[model samples]
Structure formats: C-alpha cells, structure tokens
Target: MRKKHEAPLDTLNSYLPVGAYHTVMQYLGHYKVHLTITKERRSVLGDYRFAVHGKNHRISVNGNLNAFAFLITLLHELAHLIAFEKYGNRIASHGKEWKLVYGEILQQFLLLDLFPPDIANEIKTTMRSPAAGSCAEDGLIRVLRKYDRKGDVKKLVEEIDVNGLFRTDDGRIFKRGDQLRKRIRCLEIKTGKIYLFSPVYEVTPVSHP
Candidate 1:
C-alpha cells in the first residue's frame, strides 16, 4: 500500500490520458488535496478522505490502471470529495446527493471528449444512475478493459464456460459454475469449497488434459 506523492506534470502525464493533465491537476490544486498514486488494491480502485484538523483532503488512485481508467478513477474520488464538502456526513454514500454530484462531474468531463465513443456512451448511461463503485457498470467495465495494457492474458469469470477452469492471481484454481444473478458460482480445486465471484473478476483460463 505504498503511496507516491504528486509529481511534476511531465511525470504525472504518464499516468493520465491525453488532454486530462491540466483539468485533473486543477481539481487537486483547488481542493488542496494530497493526491497519491498507489499500488493496486483488490478491493477498491480509488478512495477519498476528507481533511481533518490539520490535514488537507487526501485522494489515492491505483497506479497500475490504464491511463483512461486512471483519469476516471481519479474523477470518481474527486466527486466524493466534493459531495462530502457540500453535505458533510448527512447523506448516505452513493445516495441521491452523491449521485447528482458524481453525474455532474462526469458530465463536465464528458463534454471535454476525453473518452472514446464506446466508453463515453457507457459512461453516459452509467451517469443516469451512478453506482457506488466506479466499475459497477458492467458495460463500462467491459469497454474499459479493452484499454488495459496487454500482457498476462486473462478473461472475466463470466467469459469462461461453465465447468471450465481458471486460475486467479493468487494461483488458486477454480471450476466455473452456473451464473447466479450477478455473480458466478465457482468451486475451489484444492479446498472443494464453492464461492461466488463477481462476473468481472479477471482470471487466467486454464487448459487441462
């Protein structure tokens, strides 16, 4: 969970999409936020922490994400900061107030034509009813995955046929099962235990004789 402090725009450009440098930096500057580029975390893409007694607002985004994903994740966290600033702790997280703020912020960015057509369309649809997580929109997540850096081939759990095997990042093998609502049932090879996994969980497919 190492966090790298803000770097020069030249250095930061490596992690952001083209034409997004100034806008992203401006938000960080205006809010006096302590922006951190962090190592990947399984549970969340990015997060925000409001300012306390003597500290500035803090925001962190996973550094390993693609440039587009990086920018989107940053904006998502920025929206959280803005919502908190306006409403304190009165509103529920991802409630109406937060959704409105998030949609507004995302719409502003959309006007800049920062994203590709497919991604933009999916994002627009997502804004109508923003979800708690940035990748909550299945269509958006599927489109975003196309921009991911190529290497270490992997596929979403939903892409694998039932009974097919896949290996997670931790090297555990699982046998894919039926789809149950949004999650897919999977059986662990070693433990023979069943687990429910998000359809979007990326895993390497396994070939068995």
Candidate 2:
C-alpha cells in the first residue's frame, strides 16, 4: 500500500469561516504565529498566548465567526502579542500601552476596501477607548454580525417577546422586561438581580418561536 501525505496545516482554511481564509493566511504570514480555531464558547470569543516557556506564540479565535468579526478578534489578540514584545506585560492588560498597540493595528484595516463606511467609522471611535470585548462596542458588533450566518445574531428584545425568558450569549438566563433607552432591564433568573441588556445583545429565546 502507498503511504498518503497530508497538506500543511497552514494551507487548511477549513478552520476559518468563509471570507476569512485569505485574510487570515496573510495575517499568519506577517506574524509568523500559530493560529488555532477552537470550538465556539458562550463567553469568550478568542485569546492569545505569548512566546513563553519555550512555546511559540499562538492565537486562538472561536470557530464560525463572520469575516469582519474574525478579523477584528484576530487583530485584537495579535496586538496583545505585539504589546507583550514591547512592554513585557509591565502595564495592565488593557492599559494605555496595550491600547496604543491595539489602536495602531486596528487602524491598518480602516479603509473602504477592508470594511464598510459604517464599520470603519465606528472602529475609529472604538479605538479611542477600546473596549475589552468587541461585543462591548455596540455599533461595531452590529455591523460585524450582519456578515454572520442567519440566526447567529437574534436580537434579544425581538427574539424573546416581552416577559419571555431567554439566554444571553454568555449563558445567563433572564426574564425580559421593560425597555430603558437602548437597553432593556431584565431580571436575571438565577441571581434575581436586574440587569440592563442591550436591545441587540445576541440571544436565543428559551420559548418556541
């Protein structure tokens, strides 16, 4: 029997979502880093690892992300590695130093060819005081989710009817309530505490459609 050979892991774009393959390939080429596409989780989307303890630098992003989201998350983690190289974690994880590096990297993608006007504009503002999570930037996530698969971004307010129960993307269940500005004040079914949630927070309705 003849032995079979396999393609290089770097050549396999099956780990990435559609439209992200070429961009990610270029990113890996530029950084000389290891990329890992992990199973989707409810809380965290992606994370990064520094070249420490004799291990090569590695970056992991959740599987099935839309192109824009994947790019943003990838760049976000890449900034951490870049910042660590410069500052050596002397500053806070999201302090001024890291923010500077993250901002500089994010600016590289701010163009009509890379993203739409709405997304680019929002990214400009987000870089001013970059949030810890991409989901924290309402406008940015909104635009990114448009590029996601259907049913990936069900609006909390719309998906779960008023007074209905739903689970947040982060795994918290809440009983829907009245609106408060752009967010809704819902009661956490577990904690019994009222929490304000964005009307557009990605969620899955607990009850049937």
Candidate 3:
C-alpha cells in the first residue's frame, strides 16, 4: 500500500511524458486513485475500476497513447471515478451528473493553460456539455488527432484510399472498399473475406495505387 502522501504519479513517469506528468500527479493525489498502465487496450482507451474486495480505486489507460490522448483518456476515466464518488454507479454512465464532472475536469485544464491553444479551444467547445460517448465527439477528436505521434502512423478509415492495402498493428492486411454506414467495408487481403471496420480504426496503408 502506498503511504498516505505518496506521489501517485511517481509510479507512472516511465509511461507518461514530462508534459503530462504534473497534471496527472495532481489528479491522482486529489482522488487517491491507484493508476496502472497496461498494454494497449483493444476495446477502450481507458477504464476505471471502482474499489472493491479491499482493492484501492484503480484507473488504467493504454500505454502507447500520445501525450494529449493519454491526458484526455485519463481524465475521462477519472471523471468516472469522480462520478462514483458523488453518486455511486446507480446513475447512467453518461448522465447529466457524469457530464458535469467531465466538463468540470476539462475546465481546469482550459483555465490553467495546460493544453495548447487549439486543443484548449476545441475542448472548451466540446465540454460546454459533455457528450454521452466521449469517442463520438468530433471537435475533441480533431484536436487530439493533431497530437498523435507521427512515426509510421496508421490511417483511419477516412484516410484510407479506395483499393488501398492497409495493415493493422497485428499485421492483418485489408484492402479498403466502399463505405457502409458508420463502418467502411474492407477486404482482408490474406483471408479474402469482407469486413466492416470502424472509421476510427487504426490501419497502416501498405499498398497505395
């Protein structure tokens, strides 16, 4: 068990960047939350686990996320922690209470100039009233995408050209096809099977033209 005043973020400096460490440290201290960074999650960017079975309240975020994304994901899960603190999980996940807490947390960063101007402005607009699904907010995504670490980054559905060959991190290759509602139709190059991929799905375009 951590000492009563132990700096929680100290345990995370290896996973978090210098720019984001201070804010997250402060948040952890305030909430007395236990944080863990696991391998990149397949389903969600972050998750919050309520205290149970004598475990300390815990929050976990993917390890590979860029700094901005890491911060927002942390805050999103932290907002859940705060919501549970105020009103147990009896309320809906994204109800008005959760929205209020989410917005409140973002407001602190905006007011403190923690983020770049563009991102801060985008967050300000989106947090006027937090959306039910954090992933569905375009303004926030636009700002966060700008900060994505640019090394051989994968393309999302919108970035993939028709007939292009794209591969996932796990090396599954697919050919971009037509759009189908919210998902884009794709053909797995090796399997020769059609699949629908989320627009936000990350993929590296392997063959162009």
lDDT of each: 0.86, 0.72, 0.75
Best model per lDDT: 1
Give per-model TM-scores: 0.91, 0.77, 0.79
User: Once model 3 is optimally superposed onto the true structure by TM-score, how far is the C-alpha of residue 61 displaced, in angstroms?
Assistant: 1.2
Candidate 3: RMSD to truth: 4.8
Please give the TM-score that candidate 1 achieves against the real structure: 0.91
- What C-alpha lDDT, on a 0 to 100 scale, does residue 184 get in candidate 3? 91
Alpha carbon deviation, residue 17, candidate 1 (Å): 1.3
Alpha-carbon deviation at 63 in model 2, angstroms: 1.7
Model 2 lDDT, residue 158, Cα: 43
Q: Write the per-residue lDDT of candidate 1 for residues 7-60, one digit (tens) a residue.
A: 455688889888888888788888898887777576788888879998999888
Candidate 2 on 35-123: residue-level lDDT in tens? 77755465567777777787678877776677677778888888887888888867678788888998987776663257767777888
Error of 2 at 191 (Å): 6.9
Residue 131 error for model 3, in Å?
4.5
* Position 143, candidate 2: lDDT: 73
